[model samples]
Target: MSTDTSTAAAAGTQPGGGTAVQGHPGRLKPRASRPRRGPASYATVSAVAVFVLAFLAPFLIILVNAFKTSADYRSHGTLSLPSSWNWGILQDVWQRVDFTQKLLNSVETSLGVVVIAVVLALFNGYALGIGRIRWRTAFLVFFLGVNVLPQEGLVYPVYYLFKELGLYDSKLGYTLLVGVTYSAFGTYLLSSVYASFPRELIEAASLDGAGRWTILWRVILPMSWPTLSVMCIFFFVWSWNEFLYPLVLLISNENQTVPLGLAGMQGQYTSDPTAMSAAALLGVIPMVVFFLLFQRSLTRGLTAGAVK
Candidate 1:
């Protein structure tokens, strides 16, 4: 056998090789792997660029015109930059819309929703995901079903309920409703995050004589910051842009949010393009600033579930 192998090597032939393609023994060459797919085609790249520009064009136009005087906006065209910058446009808008009070309302209500939703999600997730609770699947599904049921379906009922509870047209009512509306989704997200937590750490914490809440607040929460942060961003954005609840439940200008304020501005200045543009840009500023700030945490939270 040894002689045969040595002879095959010397002859540059193997049992698997043809005479024309002979190779040394024990040096059988491996087949090449399929080549990696290259980047997207030019047409694909062009289409994506067109889509991005199409999305950004209107936003950029709005942003630029927001700084223009009404005269410039009318004369220069909607897509063009302001002929001369007017920083006062934002201030004028602030006065026109009573922007300070409305802005305060938005901050209060948005934070209210965030705190209520995320806190509930944390406790609820700890219970259903990490606790020894029974029929948690049923509970989860019920919450999901409740969440998927459209707010439009419950609008009148919720309105009447809030009215009866003396919470109608109040920030608390808006916060509670909006927070509860999204809380189910938050709970669903947090449950998945909690369930996959290291069981050994939990067991070790349990052995350390920590109370249930203590274990959750100290051990689980520190580890759960990424998920919690992402939920905060999600809930804040949702609450910030929430139109229906504020539109329906909040009647007074003082209680209305940025979106509702914009709607009012739209009615008041249906012809003032520059003012409207400024209002539109200002409405979304908080959301943009918020997402930019927590973007890293949001990214980490999103990818957390992908691994285990």
Candidate 2:
């Protein structure tokens, strides 16, 4: 019995009948097992999965049906695979809507709004944030108030004002209106951003005999470019998708944008779902391309701001 107990001690077994690992010289305790995930973890994962599916369902439906033929769509419904890819429907919609002109119009309008709005936001942010002018809070509040005002409330007044100025139904008029209106929100946003900027740098620039405009152009603008670029992306997409203002202000077919072009596809009594989906797909392609091209910029800007 003593010989057997001595053998067990050499093998890293405790005299109390507990087992010990024997890899090391001294007896080592056994490693504790990892904890298993509980029901709450599974519940969280399931909720996220459900949200993702819900969000993607419409886009998936649109994509699947976009290539389907009219007969295929009616026969199998939106969820089924296409019998044959009806690629010609896209071309048909394009020609029917004169989509080339619509695309150009959208590009022009969105870019125009971006340019005007960004410039305005820069100036407003500088004055409100850096300048530290009197009643700055009041001005910021007023700009915020402008954002809260509904577009519906201002439509008639804007229409009348444009009509009086002989700018009604003109692309220039619509661009200007949207630009100015959007700049209010831009100003509000940029002012808060600019307020957080380093005052030491501004003071140093001023000590070096730089005027406000010079300092703004050289220092603030360069440093804040990422934020501005992200804002430009947002403004471009927003303006591109705008339907109501364009419909009300731009009466001419030539001035109509991509969204208007898509809506024009709807018929009084009948509609082509396949062609409609094709047009939507076409409309979505540009924004997707735009986002892909600028995705790195967006990521960098967001991360930089977060770190700051």
Q: Of the candidates shown, which would achieve the greatest TM-score relative to the real structure?
A: 2
Alpha carbon lDDT at 70, candidate 2: 93
Instruction: Report the C-alpha lDDT of model 2 over 228-307, residue by residue, as the tens digit.
Output: 98889888998999988998999899999999999998989989999899889889999999999999988887777877
Model 2: residues with Cα > 4 Å off, grouped in runs: 1-41
Give the candidate number with the greatest lDDT.
Answer: 2
Residue 146 in model 1: lDDT: 80
lDDT of 1 by residue, 1-308 (tens): 88986776667666566332443335665655787655666678889999999998888988998998877776878878777899988888988999888889999989999999998888889998899489989989988898789778888998899989999889888889889878888888778777777899988988999988889889999888878888898898888888877888999877888888888876643568888889998887877888889889899988976766
Task: Report residue 255 deviation for candidate 1 (angstroms).
Answer: 1.2
Superposition TM-score, candidate 2 onto the true structure:
0.86
Q: How displaced is residue 227 in candidate 1, in Å?
A: 0.4
TM-scores for the candidates: 0.81, 0.86
